[model samples]
Target: MLAAGGLGTPAQAAPTVTPAAVASHQSPSAPQDLAPTPPMGFNNWNSTHCRAEFNESMVKGVADVFVERGLKDAGYEYVNLDDCWALPQRDENGKLVPDPKRFPNGIKAVADYVHSKGLKFGIYTSAGTKTCSDIGFPGALGHEYSDARQFADWGVDYLKYDNCNNQGVDAKKRYTTMRDALKATGRPMVYSICEWGENKPWTWAGGLGHLWRTTGDISDNWNSMSSIMKANLELAPYAHPGGWNDPDMLEVGNGGMTDTEYRTHFSMWSVMAAPLLIGVDLRTAPESAFDILTNREVIAVDQDPLGKQGEVVSSEGGRWVVSKEMADGSRAVALFNEGSRAQRIETTAKAVGLPQARGYTMRDLWKHSDTNTAGTIAATVPAHGTLLVRVHADRNWAQYPPALDVRAQDTVTQAGHIAPVTSEVTDLGGNAARSVSAVLTGPEGWRITPKSATSVRALQPGGTLATDWHVEVPTGTAAGDHVVQLTAKQRTRSGTWLTSTVPVTVRVGVPLPPGESALSDAEPLGSANGWGPIERDRSVGEAGSGDGRPITIGGDRFAKGLGVHAASSVEYYLGGACTTVTAQVGVDDETVDKGSVTFEIWADGTRAAATGTLTQTDPARAVSADVSGADVVRLVVTDAGDGIDYDHADWADLRVTCG
Candidate 1:
């Protein structure tokens, strides 16, 4: 009944944990077949929490969506519920009670409905005396046996045991009590320990739980998501089959971050082999959200039978390259950019532990295309984006033309304005490509003409071809995100043809007022800060807007400015009417002489002004960039060789003049 295995019991007393003890810990003996892959499901905490909408109908609708929307087939099997599902107090019989108001038909009926849909049902409870919500529902700290038996009777296949109001009890003992209780019921249930990594549960909970939260609760923002990812990325060594290091639930469809940032969130989590728990409401979710959640290729990497967590191959200046070894001898690689602008991150097949071969076949998980490479694996990853690919050595890859790396700049311009979209094509394979040609096309009624040569007779291996296109937006085009396409084609020596298509995103903006104004006074076409909002006339705070003090750099205070963190960008539409942009840029003094950053201003994608490696001790430096005939201007900040820790940067006295 207990899967025909024995689990050792925890010690009666909680032992103090030391770093040496964590390092010397042995592998967990948890059931290997319970979750051979990370569990995929929908957790209704981020989008619903304890709201009235989180009721029986909503829970059943989730099960329906998973079946109708292809999620169930994509390997999402569990429909989980987070806190506040039960009555605030226990019954006189010393048993927990489900909130009758929320579950009018009772939790057992809901579990039966979910099971009828061919999906497993999961429930949540804390290891303490009370749950995490303010309503304070009863927990299973001392009632593990009773609660476990009750859950088994209700047909709960997964149990997410949380840590709240733990009452100073030992973390290991608290979780082990519940694990042993579940075993006693003779019903197999996946155990998730939600201790928030306060006691480093990954060191001890592997054998006690199927997955453990490695960071604090995740919020729906880039700062929160990226920081949690960084924390969990370092604990890959502790994860294996039947156990995993969870960064937190997936926030892919939450409104706090852009779709690009959400993609990064999902990409990094997949590479890390973290659980794919959808944290948004599926009933009213947009198609874009579904597009991201159901990316089967990315999901495949997460569900690889090998169960090897991705490890960082290289990280420098906010650019990270991570690789996961797959069971089929392929490596899933992710090129992630945490910077403000586009950057090229590089790694090699050998670097990812692949055997030497004549060529390697690469499959882009996002683009859904295949390319051949000699060894180099590189991409100019966009800000807050990840390029996910699968690479494996192929002896016959030479029969195909090396995958041409075709890409274009993501342009931001005003309606009726002419913008330049530069593109590049490179042959990354060992074989030469013949009859190489490229073309750029825009939406209907938009004129797209090439300004450079678009064809070549022969392209040697490793050679690059650059092309420029002039994109003229019509006067009445809508002011929203638009798409442009760049297509490249080539032929192998065997007469086989190959084509690569790349999509470039263009954002149309409204022109600013024709006068001198504080840069922060106008809305930016795009803004991406490493942490928190881009503050107006204040230093970059850790959270909400207006939370920062006056913009200060080297003890100098400024009343009119913009505050940002390193790896930040703020872009504004100029309508080709602005003359010059000026600002005093330096590291913010809030960091107490501990942070370093670089500041730059770009006019129409060209660097017009820059500051060299400014530390907190450096005085504010003046920077001015000419914007003659430029349609857009961008203020940028990046980490200075060192990491981005505490890198609060400021653009003091920032002013833009137009007309």
Candidate 2:
């Protein structure tokens, strides 16, 4: 199912889509054009993920937003579908079909509605015999020609063919079959080959389709986005006018990455001339998403007629420049600073493969203005930020708004635990920002407190502000990936505002399973001065366990357990999220002067479970405690009687249960 948590609020009741509402789902002239520039539009995968959130009504709403929000005017025409739309089996005539319940009116019914809004329609399919859905035989494997004909007849203008359940078929042969099928239909539907970049499709996908994927699926995270871009940047030569190298779908408006990260993502995609198909629900996207998605200047650079991809011209000191050559002799340069703080990036026109030395108009692509620069252009790029500027004889660049840098350090976190998030923001751009404040947004009922001051009076260029925030995760919070955005808002004197966002992904682990382990199985963290990573049956004072110090703790099923001497403790992550822990602790019968020892379990800062002092001849007592929300678990043994005489204790049959 699609993870739509980050897109927007929950869906609302919407108008149903009907075939008659749209006029036969056909374009007036067979859609003469085919992604001359990378196709731009909204895809449901990132936002809806082929989950129940996507329906006929929702898709209709997407088209409605496309027109209502000026996305159509911005050239984002194709509204694509990714997966999970097909029924389990084909019709009696061997034709694929959409899920009747969701698309009650049928595929053409929705396609017609999309066409009525002056937008193209796209559908998804897998090359493997069984689409990704193993339960339902929905893959378009054997029915390539028939399926293509059916789609063309239904006015489907674009096809997003995926690779899944291929059953060992050749990628070229399978995708080639669909390409030929689309050609046979005589309909000019844009074919998007989605082979997941496994077969090095860029090498052979020159004319296979309008675009071919050069990487695997892209997650809405900084690492996922940047990792793919780093790979696609190396394949710029393979991208041309018709055949494009697809990095993946756009994650803008998905609420996963920060606005800055999304800008970087969009900028990189444009630089590569990859497909600009957005994977967010446009209906509920915020204005920030709108600004990033429909930036005419950025879109123009992407749609440049030359169809040349930008290459990594220079990379050093965590700063890099990727510039693309346009047909009009202008160059689109993306100056990126991947450093932790602000970096002053500078380069000469000749450095970026420009023919002339000077006399080029350097326009700030993001700001949509000409920067005043001639021979050498320099700008301070923010951390994890980009300065997209088109340099040519058009004009010069202008002073930039103060760019802030926000940072945080949490990737995986635990529910019911409080973790500290730290950020060091700096003013990387020209002017001073008046009243800079750190704004935080996250899940419902989350209590966030900044340990240090959250706001600063004035942040001048080169000045940095630090904020340490603590987030308390509530119990019962679902386990999965959750994003928290830390934004630094800069209110300037000129009424100009700039906001920098840092996205924190917290992956909560699942609860611990019920299992018993021998005391020897616990991996020890050597904390005792030296010689202490106590192994199973090993004594704490020596190289081996059980140092022959008269320690013998046994149970009905087994005999060995953690043999701990006085003043020793062991730690564990509990292997998983444990809800309860139980164990037996006692002194071995062999200890003649077995003094006394106590067993205790500590979680975080509180002692959760404990066992009474045990002496020789005392039956192994079962000690149990509720650790429903515990993460780090520790077991400690302490001497209760005379100085380490014979205080050997064993914790046996330790069992942890999640329930």
Candidate 3:
């Protein structure tokens, strides 16, 4: 039976797409010309999949938002539906039919409306007998040619062919059949193979589709995002112009993660050269989400003419450096922090494959500003965040202002306490900078006072300047990551003013009392779990707070500790007052002898202690780490080379000693 539904929003209603309207549009270009660069657009699966609200009006409104919100101008051309847009069964003529309730005027009418907005329209179907949705919409398995012809008649410009209920068919054969069918239509629709990387589509899909999913579906969380990143990072060579390694869709503007994490998500996608498909409802997205989604500099990297995906240059202890060569001879570098605490991540321009020069221009993609670096590229990147920069050999050092390599260290402060913040600037240019000055500014209601001379008469080439400020956080200010802006300015010979700005993340936390105490009793200064909230005195449960059973590891029960999923981190600001941290760590008994994990404790970006692989069959291992004089303590768990399934880990009886 066909289910019916109305459009979700009542915004500017579009008329039914008529046959004449379809006739008015011309056929698209050849398949090779489909996506010269990775496609940038919207897909509804991640946000509103199979929901009653995902109707014709909702899609039409998306097309409107694309145009009204400057998304089309920003290079997002397709408005794509994911699943459940059609009837459970095809029509008697063997044509896939859009649900009458969902698309009252039929799919062609909606495609026409989308085309009217100067945007391409895309529909979804599976290679198997049924779609992935619960309703089991009819798929284009044996009826590929008929369905493709139906799609062409309706003026569809893109097809998202999915993988579900494959019925033992060979992945390559199934996808290739659809490709042949679509090609036979001569409508020039872009094909997106949604095989979820199970068959290593990147190895073969390039010749058949514009893009292919390199990973499974992505969730709106740090773990899901980073894990997918890890999977796709090594496949850079498989991506090229007209074909991409799709890492699912963009989860930006979704409320699951913080703004900083969302920025990292978008930045990494751009660096990977993946499709930039909006996966959230644009009508109600927050301005902050829009800020991340509409970052032109980041988008430019994803759409770079070179079409080269970034590859990991180095990854150790949760710090990752990825680099991609741009068509303009520049390289996009991403300093990623997969850890829980903010730490200084450093890399050299040469390390990222840039040719040696007098100085390199390091353009901060997020800051939209240029800075000079002799060779060292470094910044204190926040946890689960990314510092994306474009570095290239300086062509005209004199034409630009002296490169100011400015950065600040991560600071941990308490409410109403004055903390010393330092900013270091080096002149990486061949020319001197006159009237050099620096300033530090804090958030509103916080006071920042200069502690050292903020100005120097002149900064010669290769000279370095260190400035200091005392930042006082207001009492009662919420604890967490706070921004402290460091700005450096200088005057060029042409009387032009140049300035470089970097943000220092200040964490405000309560000091631990003198004596041993259970870590679960105190709120984490920062945390990112693979599943849900960091559990207190319980096993890591399914995706909610206080949902776990008692904390138990390998038949050993504990009363005090933190339970977390694998690939998790719980950080605390120790303020150099903690002496040691001890814990009994192992895969939780809740997994019933089915999981494996490794636990590590980090102090100020250095691993203090680590446990060998502990599976559900092994007893909890006692581990202790010296945290004396360390500003922060981080507890981390990793899925031991296996998948994260049943990887519920426990830091049983975890305790920290302070003062």
Q: Rank the candidates by lDDT, best first.
A: 1, 3, 2
Point out where model 1 deviates above 4 Å.
1-23, 255-260, 407-422, 441-452, 468-485, 491-527, 539-558, 565-659
* Poorest stretch of ten by lDDT in candidate 2: 6-15
lDDT of 1 at 430: 85
List the candidate 2 regions with Cα displacement exceeding 4 Å: 1-33, 134-137, 394-659
- Per-residue lDDT for 364-465 in model 1, tens only? 898787778999998777778899999999987775567677777788777898878988888888887789999988899999989999989888898988
Give per-model TM-scores: 0.79, 0.59, 0.87
For model 3, residues 87-183, the per-residue Cα lDDT tens digits are 8877787778788998999988999999999999998899999888877888889989999999999998899998988899999899989999999
What's each prediction's clash count? 0, 22, 0
Candidate 3, overall lDDT?
0.83
Error of 2 at 233 (Å): 0.5
Which residue window of length 10 is worst by lDDT in model 3?
A: 4-13
Off by over 4 Å in 3: 1-30, 286-297, 339-343, 366-373, 380-384, 412-418, 443-449, 470-483, 492-497, 505-516, 572-580, 603-606, 626-631, 641-643, 657-659
